[model samples]
Target: MNALRTLISLVFAALLIAVGAFPTGAAAQIGAKSEVHTEQVQARLLAWAPQGVATGAAASGAPGTVWVGLQITHQPGWHTYWKNSGDSGLPTELQWTLPPGVMAGDIAWPLPKKIPIANLANYGYEGTVLLPVPLIVTPEYKPGPLTEAMDIGLKASWLVCRQECIPQEGEFALRLPLRSSTALDGGAFEAALKSQPAELTGAQQVQVAGERLQVRISGLPEAVRGQALELFPETPNILLTAATRGDAPGPRSWTQRWDGAVWTADVPLSPDRADSPADLPLVLVTDDGQGWRADATVSGAWPAPAPVAAMSPALEAALAANAARGAAGGGPAVAPPAAPAAVPAGTFTWALLGALLGGMLLNLMPCVFPVLAIKVLGFARHGDDRRAHRISGLAYSAGVVLSFVALGALMLALRAAGEQLGWGFQLQSPLVVALLGTLFAVLGLNLAGVFEFGQFLPSGVATLQARHPVVDAGLSGVLAVAVASPCTAPFMGASLGLAVGLPAAQALALFAALGLGMALPYLAASWLPAVARALPKPGAWMDVFKKFMAFPMFGTAVWLLWVLGQQSGIDGAGALLALWVALALLLWALGLAGRTRWLIASVALAFGAFLAQAIGPAVLRGAEPAALQAQAAPAAGERWQPWSPERVQALLGQGQPVFVDFTAAWCVTCQYNKKTTLANGEVLAAMDAARVQTLRADWTRRDPVISAELQRLGRSGVPVYVLLAPGQAPKVFSEVLSAADVKDALAALKS
Candidate 1:
């Protein structure tokens, strides 16, 4: 989350704070629904791809007739969607009021495709599309050259998207010679339009005329649609709508049977139902198998009359004028509210304190517990290995402390650039996890007496190589802190929040303070030479202790397996098991022939191969969204997604704060704040009611979308409880929530 936040903040600053100064070349960055385009052509009210067409259209050069189309050009390994821009994205559309001597026509859609968006899937274009249209010039048309300097001037609107979406608009001008109907633009555009399947030339009704509910899909299958197809309705006023938008269940074939001779399309969705009225254009979008997309029309489909209620008071006031001009009509209306003032200083102070306390308490978390056991056990077993125990404990303690400073410093650097970071984030990265896994696995094998590390020359075990009293103890302190910190929690929230937001000097002081808190016990324990001296001399007990260390290490192995599972799934876990077996066998071989470095090297090679397979895909992602999201998300510490019940229980067990937000697509309020307030650093920090674990649930689609998640959260609608708990029952906020609202809830939870 921090990495993306850093980039986003940078981009946001360039766009909002310093216009046209973005270093990455996007001089024109706008809000989600807003776009600032400097391109050659302005888009239309809606740009129909193959599967779906926009709401309104102008008739072509023919009288009492019209046509619209979706043009597509696919790129290798990439494709643009037709009607159903599968998985996630808006389909093309166009809405217009016909000019005085013109009659409108329906779209001539091209084709469509199916795309996968990680956990979800969608159908759309991966390349480019040039949707065409035919407008009808009525007899009222004033013929020819002199009367018109330009052909037609129409307002265009549409949403263009890649991984993200941006709305576009422009004026489409087409001049026509009333007397001579020579092909315009050499008919190149027309020829391309003709290349499209005629079935999609624009028809709305598809019923057997006899069968009651028989299905009939008019569009033909193209390569872009792949071996299957999914239906998407353009508007309201149609029967059998749901049935049309779904993929055919069998092998590589689509069947739209006539349902007892009736034309039908699904009903339209609305924020307010009363506003729904007959007359809007109903476009049904469908996909071809591979790439191109085309949507003719599903008969009996039309958009509901505009919802006057969704308009603001000002816009609603225009309802009268709009009615005079035949604008959208309907009921109750509301205005978008204003945002509140900037956050207060006091809120920041508490957040910082929470981060601090959380960091201080992290030394005791179960995640770090195994590492500590080994640290403690190492010295106890080797406490007498040296002549005296004076420097042993201090050396180990030093290693732990130093490693922590390095981590703290790196996190601080990222936060300075406006990142939202959390503790134990390193473990979340596959590279780091795999490396740690390798480190621990080797250490475990060494402890099992396969070979021992001396830290320096002939060195293997970090504990064995410390040369001097101070350096050895200091290095040990550094190692302990490094190994232990990534797994601990509780006070981490406050600590991380403070480190990220405060001035560098203050942040370092706070971090050092937290480190001091962690090192305190060991510092004290190290000072007592008598305690170390009291331990039994090295013998079979030493072997037992060494073996004991392996168990914690074995635990580390298991933890790595879990992390691997998170990355590559069960297959990755399987490979890890194979690596383990190979390791075990090699270790056995080493016991029989300790001096055979080549044999051991081969085992190391096998482990390296295992790591390559586990982390290969993630490494190649570069700046892909999934990788970026992972970088940005603070590891839930031990929990995964917010929707998981197992994670909720784990957080509850720790008595930590759990912040969960139920959000959705249909809600404007949710979108507004998520884009503005919720993702902000201030909001993230204010969330320190207790050690906070943040979770987001995205609600986009209607049924399968909300259904699957709702079953998990045990909720029906969104804008629900954004539960925040410090150490108690979660404090819940209502649907129309805010940043301050969350802050206040967090404050209450802390109390």
Candidate 2:
């Protein structure tokens, strides 16, 4: 019951936050003319008459209609869509709230240009464009006192695009007084009206001819008889919007031929077509911006609809909520809210550099230290064998590179299959965590000389390792990556984040770069004769050195156990500890005499297998619901609170500064920060002084919400530090955090 309740809470919070988490790019005070600005565009609501207008004063008389235009000014190279967005975009939407009897007409869409990105063609407007909507004042509206004015509120949303897409919105309220009209903005409105497509009085027909859509029209303007005309379909999914080859403005999207008076075109229909209509609506625009609208009868049936692609759970829920909200407000459904994908911080070259540097730095992290120490011991063991050292180094480098590529490929594949995942996703599973802990324990025991595999194995099996010395080094590289990848180094966060959004070939290249970087040090040590000479010669003290290195492996195992405790609670940790004792017994039994060894090994193996079968599911599946919630909660008197999208948004809406720590227990870097800088009293005092709400987003478990939020910020792992102030862009901190970094960020938030 508690589990079900927790699920319900998560669902409700996700849906509720979807309404406002990514809403309204800008805010403004209500007025006769209101303007809101985003990074890429400016949106303004303007009345046709700037000064007040009295009823029945104009020649048309008696307060019939007034025009209000939503004007959008785009930055160079950016554009917003028309009523029907072609290929891969969403159309702008307007929802109005007005006084009784004042109804709003649909937007008077202007002529759209074919804006192309890569090979996809989009129907949208560039530069500056005004969408005019008429407000109809019915007889039911009565004139009030002289001071009375009409109040109109509008919520507008649009998707702007260049190389990437950004979804933005604005809320505006306008108050128009009852007085005389000045008509100051009349020219803008008139221009928009002139740009509107003229209704066609010509013969228009459409037929589905196999895989193509055949459209025919006649009675165009005489001047346009021999001129090439551009076709803009009003109804979506009727024809392919992407070109057959090359980018836009190159080859014509559709084949066009004019036979003197009549115009005819054969365009391939969309393979993923989702709509079929009896009437086909299209707009034909000429070179001079003059356009004609045609509503033509269809003569044949559309092809069978293609299977729809699945949506992410977050998107699916957001769409459902949008539909519900639209029904409640009695308006058309608006576009779903979206987190603006932050443009990658740098270019592909920079990303590759970051990945390379990040991988090199991973050698310094504690989680990876144990593996490096073992590799150092191996180098010491083979100090006199230069050829062997070089061969082992090559094998190790190959292992690291191939392992990183395989892991990167799997992550990409899962993401393509609609899983909201990120780097270090493997650590989210308790089973993987348990298995890694056991593997480390075995390594620690071997290093400590508890049992050697060769002592018990047949001569044939034991000699296999002696025959292939490089295999051991290769396996060590794989083990290093398995343990170290979770500790996201400085540049790795951004590089990994950007990688997930890039093309497969490029993304995998970045991953391979990271692996190559990690292997560089070992390769250099093996290849450089001077570096090898610098190493201490092997001696009796080497055994003690090896034994000392065993402690780090044991330490790593203990840390993994702590991480498991965080994920599955104390009981699960205890269960694993019991399994470890059985494992130790089996290892010890291998060193005993024949009969005793067999007898004890038999008992130990049976006991370990039984325990695993009985408690493995319970431990690996994680803690009970109550325990998980309790773990999520902050301890007594702690300033930090558990994070949710709604919580962060609610605090921000109240003008509160918020600091979010996107972290996980398995992340070694995250644990270090939590123990050091984040726990500092001075940092806490500064945050409290600024009244910043501290939120801890625990990603110890698989959390789709946190994963989605991370992707939005262009990060694939923790610890991600985000400082957000109301009405300001978010400030993201580096992965290697510090006390001074916190204080500086807080101080800036105050400033």
For model 1, residues 1-751, the per-residue Cα lDDT tens digits are 0112122223322222121112221111110111112222222222212211111122233344333333333334433334534333455565544557665566555544445433234445555456666665565644343543213445555444433333334333333333333333334455546445433443444332221222333344343222333444333223222222333432222344333332233222322223222323323333322222234323343344335433223323432433433323222222221221223477555554654455446656655665556556555755545443446555555555556667778876664443434566576555455545645665666676764333111332333333344554564465455556565467565455545545666566556666666765655665676656776665777678777677777677678767765554444454445545555554445444345655665775466454434433332111111111100112334322423334455576677767765554433345445555676766677764355776654443222322333433444455555574433434656555567877777676657
Worst 10 residues of 2 by lDDT: 624-633
Model 1 lowest lDDT segment of ten: 27-36
Cα lDDT, all candidates: 0.45, 0.73
Q: After aligning candidate 2 to the native by TM-score, how far in Å is the CA of 173 from where it should be?
A: 54
Off by over 4 Å in 1: 1-304, 308-360, 378-390, 418-420, 453-472, 529-537, 576-623, 626-664, 667-751
Error of 1 at 342 (Å): 17
Q: How displaced is residue 172 in candidate 2, in Å? A: 48
Judged by whole-model lDDT over C-alpha atoms, candidate 1 comes out at: 0.45
